[model samples]
Structure formats: structure tokens, C-alpha cells
Target: MHRTASIGLAAACLAAAGVAQTASATAPETPATYLERIAAIDDAGPAIHAVVAIAPDPAGGAQGGAQGGAQGGGPLAGRAVLVKDNIETRDMPTTAGSLALKDNATGRDAPLVARLRAAGAVILGKTNLSEWANFRGDRSSSGWSAVGGQTRNPHALDRSPCGSSSGSGAAVAAGMAWAAIGTETDGSITCPASVAGVVGFKPTVGLVSRTYIVPISASQDTAGPMTTSVADAAMLLTAMAGTDPADPATAEAGRHAVDFAAALSGASLRGVRVGVLRGQAGTTPALTAVFDKALADMKAAGAEIVDVAFKPEARMGEAEYAVLLHEFRKGIDAYLAGLPGQPPARDLAGLIAFNKAHADAELRWYGQEIFEQALAATDEAVYRKARQDARRLAGTEGIDALLARHEVDVLVAPTTSPAWPIDPLLGDHFLDIGAGSLAAIAGYPHLTVPMGAAEGLPVGLSFIAGRWDDAKVLRVGAAYETVRSARLAPPSLRRWGE
Candidate 1:
């Protein structure tokens, strides 16, 4: 039977038990209700295309149902949560926005998804993403996927939603879910959340398990929370974080996974040291003004601001790119090989072949040069060197050094410029840069909170700190969020130049 039909009576029962309480209504909104709401926004009304698949059962599905759902217990009780399509779910196919994986449903929840369910969160569905987490091709649109088409910016239909967590960000911004999970290898999570006017938190690499998510760069990839507020991000992160033996990087996660929401209770900017990364803030005059106003707000909140500067080596980007190529080849190969049954594409080469075979749909907009490059990158020695350079430059000599030199508790910058127009013919035009690269490569905690809107486009203020300081970063973000004056109005869905 369909989940909504089967669960209707049980949902009514749960509603009476206070499992479905919502801020907007006294009437209990069950997981099925959330699904219906999301479908209207994603498929019917605005046609945001944020959601790719809905779970027949949130507790568990074809993989074998778990007795967990809105009834699992805790802060997320009855909360409907969406995850990036790259993250596996028991009922929904984890397509990573690729048509090749449309039928590749593994019938297993990713460890992180299981954790969320265990915390009373109902796994609403999988959100669309940039295909292959935005690593499949060159000149590709940020939110387009062969499986789900394009996810338009909720702010402005003509604008880009960024990527590869584009749908996750957009879903939360549009209030389709209480919160969503997004994976970032670089700017995937923060960029989309910023552009979509939501809060996104990219925890330190080892702070969250990455098992069962689609691969890009093992060294850089991580799943995190995308929500409309920092407190919601904290609540989601609290459930999502834990040590997974299968993911060796998360060996220390158990140690860092404390009560993140608890930290927010004491969040205060008073007497806190804040480092302003003026150089990283883009030169867009309106965005710069928004950032300046944010800095002033921090001061009014009692934060002591100190200007800090750090320049990355020109080779850092090149080295990071090389490392990603090497790791994508090995990591994706292993992930595909481990799948339970025969899949259309078992490795990078197979994926490339599959795309070419279905080029009419997959390659209609762009070419998969990144896939080709990753498949051909067989030089382990060069990969090792590049990895070393990237880590040192981004970590030791970059974020870490800058923090120590400036004696600041945390660093802040404008996350990115306002959303740009989506151009299928030309691809992403990043009018300005952000602070995502340094923290992404360094495996540090990064948080982006909506700062303000510029020309009807939302931008965010980024908070980045040293590794394992996830709680601290959230606290600081929350502190700023509480005091910020700018509020994002609902998306206008306006045409370009409107």
C-alpha cells in the first residue's frame, strides 16, 4: 500500500500523542502531509524541481522497515527532512541526479539517514542535485540533472540555485521541509544555501559519516545540514553526526558529536573575537555593503572585529583539482563495485560510456570532460604530491595560520555573490569568490547564515573555524543570526530584470 494511505490512521494516532506538532498549525502535519506539501511546490506550483523522490516509508522501506519515524523520539519528532539525492535511502533511489542510477536503488539507508530516523526525523525524500554532485562535466548548470531536470532558485526563477546540494538548499528556503541534508566537496552546500537564503553547515570532515553517499573527493566530501535557520541546522546536525566504523574518517566523530543545540543556548557574541576576511568578500558593491552592515551588526552584538588577511598560493587550486580527480576515480570505483547487484555503470569509465550512450539527454547541455579527466588520471605519485600540497596550503599554512596570526576565535566573510542568472549555454558565471575553498580543503567547520538580500537576491555571511570546532562555529553563527537586521522575504519568482 502507499505510505500515505497506510500511515494515515497511524499518523492520526501519532498526532494525538504530540508527535506532529508544528509551529504553523495546531493540526498535526505528518510525514505524508509534508510529502504532499513538497510535491505541490516542487512539481505543481512554482515547479522548483527540488525534490527528486519521495519515500514510501520514512522509517525504512524496501531495505526492510525499521520501527522508526516521527515516533523515533527527540527534537526532530515529526519533522520532515530531505536529503541530497546523492545520499542513500532505503525506499528512494539515490540517483545523484544521474539517469544512470535511476533504477540503482540499493534498498539501504545511508548511516547518516538512519541516524536521522533514529532521532525522530521522517525522511521525506531525496532532493535533486547537480548530477554527480556537480563533478560530472564542464560547463554544466548548477542544479540541472538528467533524472530531475533543473531546480530553479526559489528567490528568482531565472537565477541559479548553485550546487551540488542545490535542491537541498532550495527545498529548505522554500519551506518544503523542516530541514535538509546536503553534501559538499567544495562549495556545494554553502554556495547553494547562501544563494537560496538558507543556513548551511559543513562540519569538519570527520564529524559526520559519509558512507553510502555518492563520491567525489573522499578527502573533501562530507554531508551537512541545510535549513532555514541556524538552530534548525544544529538540531539536524545533532542527529546526523556519529561515528561509523565503515567510514574511517569518522573515528573521532563520537567525540565531537555533542549536543549542538545545547551550545546555542549560550551563544553570545559579547567578548568574542571575530576575524573579518575583507579580501575574500567579493567586490560587488551591494553585496559588500550588506557584508559591511553585517560586520556592524556583529559589533553592535558586542563582537570585537579584527581585520585579517591570507592569500592562497596560485597552485593550491590546481593541486586541489588534481587530488579530486585522483580520489574521484578510486572512490567512485570502490563505491560502485560494492553495490549489491549489477549496475549500468560500475566505474568511472562505465559512467562516461553510459553518458555517451544516452548523450541525447545527459549531454544535451554540457560535456563530461571531468569524467574523462578523472578516468585518465592514473598517476598515484602526482596525486600524492598534489594531496600533500593541497592539505598544507589549505590547512596548516592557510586557515590555521590565518587564525593563529590574527588571534581571532573565528573568521568571517561574505559566502558568495548574489545568485546569478542560470545560463545553460554558457554555464556558471561566478561573478565573485567566497571563503569556501580554504575551509573545504582544510576539512574545517564552515557555516553560512543569511546576511541580507541584494537586488532581490539573498547572500550569506560565512563563519569558518579550525577543525573539530563545529559547535563553536554554530554558536557564533547563531549569535549573529539572532541579531541580524536583514530578513529575506519570500521568493518573488520574478523574471530576470524584474
Candidate 2:
């Protein structure tokens, strides 16, 4: 079938299956113009706090204005994007959703930000995130932060938006921005995107530069795109990727970077081998039903699917947690030291003290058990061993071994279960899910595409590809997205105070 026909056929199937489509009537405009629209929407009454700050220049009036007329003809000339607060932009402050660094602004843009600006994408603003990317406390709510407050899910006002990259996901879903940049150390991007009903791509470590992003762990830290469509994610990623002299890890990215949007042909998934990770199943019956339907769609699209069962050792999660705690302290210290102007928290010790001093504001709901644990573990030797073991087991023995044995291009699983009930008093009811650990431990690329709705909430099907295979992952995701046709329209209450 022709590519366009395939999309039409897929759309028809989805509509028949009860997926309603809402047409957006707005015509294409420059990125600068888009920002102006955002300001008009957000600044009015019932304003949602999705955006932390807007850039000084509104679209259309500025030199590199939002309409893509910037620098003559840049790749993302007319695209407007919201960047998560954790990713530093010289145009905005890098608060990381915390009051500790409320005034902190890096003098220069992050490498990824520089790439976006070079491609002519306008920085609409910074989106709210879980304070310190949700690494601060064991009982922290996914989307709540001391600085930005709670970001409501666009799908349901009463529901949670999920963590770390919550505002980025919500903004994209609500059409506040065409796309947004989100940083993930583990489940941050996937969880938020899954709950908000958007597409999120967590590229392999080093696939995108992490030079100015707030750190949890250098090994697992990476920035990715959260967009309404898989194709949009690919377009945003193509502009954000490439080697960065500021981050040594990006040296490995090399030619792994490619025009991901160009790889979104209809037949991209044809003859591709996909392995279903059976070990991660049995969360919710609704999710399973969606998964089955998705599998059927892929089969109709001429892709091979195999059910593979290879659960990792139980100790892997514990070991991974240990590594993150140790690395968070060290990585955060390094990041703080390099910040321009006065440092907010000079080291982990100072950060701990700052949190304690501002407990009423920062620790209103959750206690800093995770931070305390990191503070308690001062043994370097034990930390090094745990970190090494986690990487070896998760990367070499876990994900890599299973993919090689199955000979699959990607491993598929539920990005997350359904959106749990949002309870500020009790925090997130995430339970024990199979996300974060695999990708976080293995340090591989993981992408989440909207699969279907479960009880009026969104669910995402995950794609875990091998290290540095970002382009291939994007291609496969875009192809499946075309077949699934599952992107959702924002709820009626998307505008703040609605």
C-alpha cells in the first residue's frame, strides 16, 4: 500500500475501534508566533502553571521569530518548544523545580539547547518538573514540586501527570507547545509521557548531550523529546542530537545521529523483528487488552512479533538504586561547581542542609529518605562495586543478552500501567513496575508511544532498542505510530482554571 494510504487505513481502523479524532484548525505559523499564542493563553485567567517562564521575545516580532523565517531557513524554523526546567537555557532560569536555585541561570545554553537554537526552534519557556527530577524523596509525588507546584494531567484534572518531565508531557498533550524537551535519569520521561498520552523518546546515554541538564547520575542522564506524534519526536530529536565538546560522553554518538524524520517511511517496520517482554506483563487487564490490539496491528502491518521471557536477577534493582544514590551526590556536586555565578548548593551536603532549612516548603509532603540514604553512604569502594555490577548485569547480561538471543530489533513492553489515582497525601502509587530499571541499568534507548486508553487514562507501549540505535528506534516508533494512530486530543479543561 502507498504510505499515505496506509496512514488513512490505519486512521480508519483506529476510528472504528472507538478512537475519536479532534481536528486542530490552527494554520501553520512560525515558532515565534506560537510563543505569542502561548502567552495569550497562559497569561489569561484560569492560567495553568505548565510554563515556568516565557522567553523575552514573543514569536513574529523578533529576529529569529517563531514563524521559521529565522536565519533564512533553519530545520526547526517555525517550531516552538518547551524545555524542562532541568535543561539549562541561557534565555531562561534552570530551577530544576526547586526553590534552592530559583534565581540560578546558566550564562550559556546547554549543548542540546544550542543545537535547537541553531536549528531555529524558539525556546517557548521552561516546563515544571518534579523537584530535583524526583530523586529527592522516597514518597515524592510525580508531578509536584516546591517551586512550580503540582502540574495536573491534561487528560484528567484529578489525575497526576507523572514525574520529572511532567510539565513537558502535559504541555505537549495540551497543545501548549508542538514539542518539549525532557530530561530523564530513569522513568522520568516515559512515565510522564505515558500518563499524559504523548510520545516520549529517551535516547541511549550519550545520544544527546547532557552538558547543562540537572544531574541525578551521569551514567543514566539524558535529554529527550516529548511530542504529540512519533514523527514530531523524530523531528525534534534530529535537531537536538550531535557530538558536544562540553560532554565527553557524546563522543560515542558519532554518526549515530541522523535525520530521524526522514526515516519515517510507512514500510520502516516491515520485516522488523520485535520481542514482547512477557516478564513485564500482567499489570492491568485493560493494558493487556491494548497490548494485544497493538500486537495485532503490527502483525497486520507485516512485522514479526515474538514473546520472549527473560527476567533480570532480583538484585539488579537494588544495585541500580545504590548506584544512583552514590552517583547523584558526586554528579550533583560536579554540576554545582560548574554553575555560573553564585552556586545554590555547593555540594550534596549543602543541598541536604538547604532542604532541611526549608523543610516547610521543600519537604511539605515527602521526607528525604533517598537523600538521607545517599548522605549516609560515604563508602567509595562499596559504591564503585555496586555501580559496576549494575552496569554489567543490566547492560551485558540483561537487555543486551535478551535482545541478542531473541535477535530482535527492539524489546516491547508496557511503558507503564495505567495512571494511578493522584493522592497528594500519599504521593504516587506506582507500586513495583518494570520500567526505569531496565533502561536505567542497561543505559539503552527507550521510547514510549501512546498505545490506547485504559479507563479514560492513557497507556504507552515501550520500545527498548540497543545502545546508540536512536535513529532506528525513532523509525520503528514512527512506523508503529502510523499503524496505531493513537495520539489523543487534550481534555476540555486543558486551559488553567478551567
Residue 418 of model 1 has an lDDT of 90
Task: List candidate 2 segments past 4 Å from native.
Answer: 1-48, 60-71, 434-436, 485-489, 492-498
Q: What is the TM-score (0 to 1) of candidate 1?
A: 0.92
lDDT of 2 by residue, 1-498 (tens): 000102233332222223222211122345544454344333332234567777766454234544455446787775778899998888778888888888887777988988888787778788888889999887787878787888777667667888889989877776667788998888999999998888899998988999878898878889999887777788788888888987888897767888887776553678999989866865678778888888887878888999888767778878888888888888888888878888658887888889999989988898888887887777888888888888888888878888899899888888887777667788998845445568867789898988888767888888887788777777787778778855454443432234
Maximum-lDDT candidate: 1
On the 0 to 100 scale, the lDDT of residue 38 in model 1 is 59
Model 2 poorest 10 in a row by lDDT: 1-10
Q: Which pairs of residues have clashing backbones in candidate 2? A: 30-66, 30-67, 31-66, 31-67, 32-59, 32-66, 33-59, 46-496, 68-77, 68-78
Count of clashing pairs, candidate 2: 10
- Each candidate structure's TM-score, on Cα atoms with residue i matched to residue i, is 0.92, 0.89
lDDT of 1 by residue, 257-368 (tens): 9989878896889988999988888788899999999999999999999999766688989999999999999999999989876789888889999999999999999999
* Clash count for each candidate, listed in order shown: 0, 10
